[model samples]
Target: MTDHLPRIVVGYDGSASAGAALDWAAEWAELQADEPHEVRAVIVGTAMDPVLGGYRARNDDLLERWRSEAEQRLAGTDTAPGQARERVEVRHGPVVPELLRAAEQAAMLVVGSDGHGLATGTLTGSVSQHVARHAGCPVVVVRPRRSTVANRIVVGIDESPEAGRALRFACRRAQRTGESVIAVHGCFSVLAHVLTFDGAESELAARSLAAGERLVQEVCAARAPDFPDVEIEPEAIPVRPGQVLVDASRAASLVVVGSRGRDAFAELLLGSVSQHVLHHAHCPVAIVR
Candidate 1:
């Protein structure tokens, strides 16, 4: 039964942020105690020597050390009794590829961000960024938080399929954690600029707001039956989608967004709004594909 259940994989490297991610993942698994999941941690090692012209085998002592540390961390995480530290895998290869492979069939992949401020900013070449963009499953990039009192799951809502999936994911999480959901839709439309010359700016803005509200309502209504007990609050704000989500993240436990929005580039792996939120959101951000 455990093998058949979905896996929740955590990328651990013994950093503070990684330890936080492991704790978060373990607690998330505990939330699903009614239907247990397979929770595991992975540590990726290059173990390569350019001068040797071949991959060097990992020393047994070093492998055991990593495994031992990961297991200890998992055991120490706050989780329900009888929760086993199932697997602590140490794989050798490129970091991103190894982590992706470890979570190929996972329900969700949890990773840590450096929690850097605007001055330092999130690096484009970081492992979490690459994994969030390329992973087949939903990827959550967690940052160390000062508090978790804010229990709202803020999600960006739109008519796109990916956005709908993101909303569903957020609703499911809210259902499990007893958190509320905030469905936000930006009402800034390109047509507002053209209508300004004709003195129809106010009218356009009202229409845009109404349309945005309808979109959010319809989307939330569709999922209402599935999440009967989940609380959802819809908002149609006249602001940029990224900015709205970033502001909401300040008081949110988690901010969820689709990998690609309706107007995103077809060739891009990650959407601009998601990238912006991932870089700027105050809380953990989950990129659903």
Candidate 2:
């Protein structure tokens, strides 16, 4: 069994959004052609019997039909000719748990931001959000976009280790796609936490902005050598981190951010800024854990 091989697992339910996600996943897999990995689409069906324990006759029929549909959808995805056919895995259980189980040790999990059930299949509606917060690996939530700026990746940067991981992920992607990386750091929120100078609010804000600028530059500069080919455009804006990232997402092919940030609560699975960006970004958002 090639279960040990790295895999890019995608949640598919035959919805339009799921189709878009599959396309995005395919593109990502192609980008990593140098490093071999399997692209598997997981189709989840609700297990009808709660007390009876497993798939009954009706449940079996639903799962089989969904499996067939998933296979057809995989065949139709616009991947390069001669590429290995993507494998389809069918699981019968609650949607989120089953998807999480399928991708427990995957390289990454791709899911549509929203999806209708398989005919009535409760697969992706809010499922992406839950999985993004709970998934053991990185999660990329692909939302339908009316337009996208070409060859650019936006990433939120801070001093936290999580932010560093995110920047590395973005730089690696930039290396693969020949895209420029926009490293954005926001100052207002960071400053508000430590500064209590009421009368000299403006002066403190200016200092915070400067500090933020330095932090961004230093962080990007450190990673610059490793990704010499990647163009890192550092932007230290005097705005909230989440807002800056959301605005930048308008002109980014993808937005990458840490699962949590500097001020995140220790027990929280996802940070406020990351959560905000996930909900409002104009393009695909990748939450790096």
Which is the leading candidate under TM-score?
A: 2
Best candidate (score: lDDT): 2
The local lDDT score (0 to 100) that residue 136 gets in candidate 2 is 92
Q: What lDDT does model 2 reach?
A: 0.82
The residue-by-residue lDDT of candidate 2 on 1-289, one tens digit each, is 3465578899987777887788888888777766656678888876655556543665667667766776776677655444554688887778888989988889999998888874343545478888888999999999755355467999999888989899999999999999999999987754554565655556677778899999999999889999989999999998888899999888789999998788767326544888888789989999998
Provide the overall lDDT of each model, using Cα atoms, as 2-decimal numbers: 0.79, 0.82
The lDDT, on a scale of 0 to 1, for candidate 1 is 0.79
Residue pairs in collision within model 1 = none
Q: Estimate each model's TM-score.
A: 0.86, 0.86
Give lDDT: candidate 1, residue 243.
Answer: 88
